[model samples]
Target: MDISLWDQLQSMDKPQTTLNNSVDRVSDEAIERYARSKWLRHKVDDYIKDDKFRRKSVEAFHADLQKLSNNDAKSLLHVSNILDNRSLENIGLDSGDYRNLLITYLQSRQDPLSTYRELILYKIHNVLPEEYLGWFKDDLRCSLFLAYLVKDSIFINAYKGREELISVVTDYLRYEIHMFIEEYTQNLPAYKVDYKGVGEHKTVDILYAKSVYLKNRSKEKDLKWLDSSNQHQIDWTYNYLNEEKRSYIILEDIFFPQTKEEKYELIIASLDILSNVEGTDVESLAILKKRKGDTKIISRGNSERIDVIQRMKKAWVQLGTDTKNSKDKLVLNITNKNKEKLVALAKNVNQTPNKFINQAIEDVHREVFKIDG
Candidate 1:
């Protein structure tokens, strides 16, 4: 994948970031006037690159943003595209040139309010957390980052705006913490899956062993990003986890189910592996108990649990079924025997039934609609 706009900025050496304590020092009226002029593009590059300018501009934007009602803030942040066609004409442009082009597009517009709104977006893009910069591709992350900046300040809970912001922020943190926990849990011996070998069975597969070792090494590198001094991020994570008696296992947001029943199925599928851990117990597993009261899932025999859990985790990570993407559900009516075979085949390859079926359909479609190269 191509490096995103914000990720490029984050790669800079000693790009200074500071909280502007006073908004009055940064003049929004003057910015708007300059932005309205045609000559604005000439100064855009210098202003954006200057750390002091960005700090003051961001502070002024922060003040302006809080004054608006929730609906207005939402509207201002809802941009159709980050860069216009003219700005994107040269894909080979370096990060600095790209940033210059984007700011020029934002300020080149005729409507001052529209230009200001675009500029606020530009400011937010500049101030994103460096640790999670790569994950800033979506609007959800952008909104969450903005909320983190201003969440402590007053917002009308009567409008449910504050409540909504907190809910989303918590949900995001839940998934983040869950990944942290996975780093340890995935290394447990009980989590290992018995692979259905192609050629011959062996006591140990050298390649698989090496892969596991490499994976653990990568996890150690990822853990370094988890060490953060940002108080807002630390507080949000601590408060959310503390709210529950036992920590709730939140599915990654992309793969989170739309219905309660699907969520229950996912939790049930994961429990057999979770339960085998040495210190795990009913009191320790809050989400499973809440979703399904049956204690049997926890104590169930490890007959096929490893395969199920592996398949679920792989499918969950592979699928990006966010509501933002348009999709159509296909209902297939098949005989029981065929369905059993399908399920068995999917499990062997560590895929969900839906994903397996979709892949099969796509394979056939590509063959039927073959194009000569």
Candidate 2:
């Protein structure tokens, strides 16, 4: 519905006399007078109930009303005589201030498209499974984050043109909304609802309105709410994740928990390994967000994995195992005292006993045979 400036000003002339002292609402009289359609009237009603639009618009309208000309004061006085002056006063308006009040009231009505965009994005952030959000938000950055949020190949295939990217995001929004409403609200056999319901303020009508709005508005400013940047750190994150993509599909997978204790154990284990790696500075190269019991590990460094993998290779060689070739373990009976001595020697040289003993035996054998000479 396109309301011209002429229409907006013309509608303001009509009087809105209805009042409810108990709660703030746009009366049916005002709805019928201004909305001009049954569907829009229902949307207007829901819009008032919606905390986002109502609270914001009302607060803004009050502030703007104070700045409007005093010419409306006489009109406010006339309205006070016809309606509950106390209610008008409570809302910070004189009775004849009806024109601006009605205009503001109608303005508070949501554009179903914008409402849908907001709700779908909200659902993505708050209601969808955390795994999906984590995958898109944690790993993917820049416009790539928005691209992955769609979970479709279209944006990538299309070379991510601005309009094409927007279309993909909008398509995803509608798809998710349909799936959520069908699975949670409409499909009674599939989903068992508690007495309180899956969502309280988030009713089917509200969701449906938002979906309709999203479809209508996707081409316009639907994506304006999305941050200009992908809300991720710029430094090292992209390079690191890209480089380690094959080994670590998602960084969060490293911190996944079998139990709470195991989750913490993984964090400690990573820290222990990374901390002990020689010839590399893990702390300077990586950012690990660990505080006591918290299990989250955000690796925003490029060379952290490189350092860790190198250390693991060194450990395997020290254990008498070749990473590239299969090697059978060699066990020999040795006196406890000599074994202890070998362990001490290995510790002093920062080598495993297996590595130290093998090197010592080779050196003695070479000397006895004069192998090099």
Q: Candidate 2 has which clashing residue pairs, if any?
A: 75-96, 76-95, 76-96, 76-97, 112-213, 113-213, 116-210
The TM-scores, one per candidate, come to: 0.21, 0.20
Which stretches of candidate 1 lie above 4 Å from their native place?
Answer: 1-93, 111-114, 117-298, 303-373
Task: Give one digit per residue, the lDDT tens place, for model 2 in 197-311.
Answer: 2344324423433232222211223223222233232112222323553332222321223333332222222222222212224453232222222223343442343454444
Candidate with maximal lDDT: 1
Distance from true position, residue 37, model 2, in Å? Answer: 17
Given candidate 2, what's the lDDT at residue 220?
Answer: 20
Please give the distance, in angstroms, between residue 227's alpha carbon in candidate 1 and its true position after superposition.
Answer: 28
What would the per-residue lDDT of candidate 1 be over residues 98-118, giving only the tens digit for each residue?
434444443444432345544
Assess each prediction's global lDDT (C-alpha) against the native.
Answer: 0.37, 0.36
Model 2 residue runs over 4 Å out of place are 1-8, 11-373
